[model samples]
Target: MATDQHLTEHTTAREELLKGHVLHVVRDTVRLPDGASATREYVLHPGAVAIVPLLDDGRIVLERQYRHPTRQVHVEIPAGKLDAGEGALACGQRELLEETGYVAREWAYAFTMYPTVAYSDEAIEIWFARGLEHRGARLDEGEFLDVIAATPEEFLGWVREGKVNDAKTLASALWIQNVLAGTWKLDWQAPPDQP
Candidate 1:
């Protein structure tokens, strides 16, 4: 009988499997609630932030880049992993500028989601940004991508057609749709040190 009071798995042993630049893998042995033991493998992530950048003209910013693992070009909202001790909002701002050459005067923290709950501890913070101003992009060396601008409806259509299947992008597009429709509310705020 797995009840709320005794359902938590106890970690009996843990081993670091691999430590890469972006991904850290670990294997754990756990004692189950029913007194059974099992091994679980998962990735340790630093977490990341994804931004839904809404321009004043009602278009949203996106990116199409080649993903090595999938070997496919994926359309995604501007996002990046959090640097050590970096705030999510700052990471969002940085990614937006570097990836899309845009900046937003107003920003909002939308929601947090876990994309691979079964196998990874990766959390993505979704952010909403508006009052945008365009600047020249400063892409990282060797970073190649095409910037795309589209309305929420267009993005939703892509999602329906299986063209935008990246988990974080799908979530961001949904957030954009509802937020623009007034069904979802965001606590929008001015960028720091600004009115």
Candidate 2:
């Protein structure tokens, strides 16, 4: 509501730490509001989108894949990073079709979340999709995962049992619960015409 200048930190200098194929790391010297200088190290991400694909039978589409960083198989929503110059909805559609093989007739924007606010500038745009038509999955090279469908109750149960622990997925669970209960409303729309 009010201005946040009191809590702002102005960057004094920046240094590139690492530039990888997927991750760009940087360090910045900042002048805090209290007149103190400090260094902040974080990853500059290309941003991403996660899709909560819903079925006519009230089930949700999900992926079971082994994440190398966590060294575990996680049950998560279909998601992928944005390509150069890609919009959030476009990324969501592409990822949903590419990862799960089902394209939706209706779509809605849920919300955006920063998975690791302290260390990564990675903002994930969450979307909702329904009226799905299955074509086939087009997995990227070296990418492997299993697509599964679950009822909301079953999925939430897995979450309660500590099975679905992905940050983005957890955030989507909150949205899904609220939306199902009619507490949160979504403005559903038709997919844009393809080129």
Candidate 3:
């Protein structure tokens, strides 16, 4: 049987305005079975996408770049913010090209992430990309990075060794393993990749 970890009891205690980006305040004052109540405030974000582009021989492509917010260079799956109204796969393809300068023969939307529900609305759609061939990057202004290739086993090992710590990348990499092993599924009506 599948285990259900959903919280059984919880209610909003209060909300405060700390900053603006889609309501920056949140409170979790609702009591639990153990009589515990706590309040937490977190940031809100629109959402994004992550692409795990894989090579026919099992290698996965990653990008190393500086995240201005963290002020650290981190290796992550190719990803980007949604356009004014761009679909996930479209955005994923664009990001794959812009960040890694590569294209895939096939790609599939794998899953999604809420980052932290208690914190923000930054959900991200993860894509599993394959059939890769180099195409060269189309970097936008002020962007810089290098493409690094690692095998799937190496990628997962990196996660275990604390090298690939990006949440979306980790989750999507695991999902790719599952999907390739026939244990994962796609939505019945997944939106088609934008041309």
Off by over 4 Å in 1: 1-3, 193-195
- lDDT against the true structure, per candidate, is 0.90, 0.95, 0.75
User: Which runs of model 3 end up more than 4 angstroms from their true locations?
Assistant: 1-41, 185-195
Sort every candidate by lDDT, greatest first: 2, 1, 3
Q: Candidate 3, overall lDDT?
A: 0.75
Error of 1 at 57 (Å): 0.8
Where is the poorest 10-residue window by lDDT in model 3? 186-195
Assess every candidate by TM-score. 0.94, 0.97, 0.73
lDDT of 2 by residue, 1-195 (tens): 999999999999999999999989999999999999999999999999999999999999999999999999999999999999999989988899899999899999999999999999999999999999998998999999999999999999999999999999999999999998899999999977531
Q: Residue 113 deviation, candidate 3, in Å? A: 0.7
lDDT of 1 by residue, 9-95 (tens): 899999999999887999999999999999999999999999999888898889999999999999999999999998898898988
Clashing pairs in 2: none
Tens digit of per-residue lDDT, candidate 3, span 1-195 = 865445565665766556564345554466664667765556656578898887788788888888777888887888888876877778888888888877777777677888677567688988877767677788989888888998878877888898877777777777867876779874423235423
Residue-pair clashes per candidate, as listed?
A: 0, 0, 0
As a whole number from 0 to 100, the lDDT of residue 80 in candidate 3 is: 86
Better of 1 and 3 by lDDT: 1
In terms of TM-score, the best-performing candidate is 2
lDDT of 3 at 188: 28
C-alpha RMSD in Å of predicted model 3 compared with the true structure: 4.5
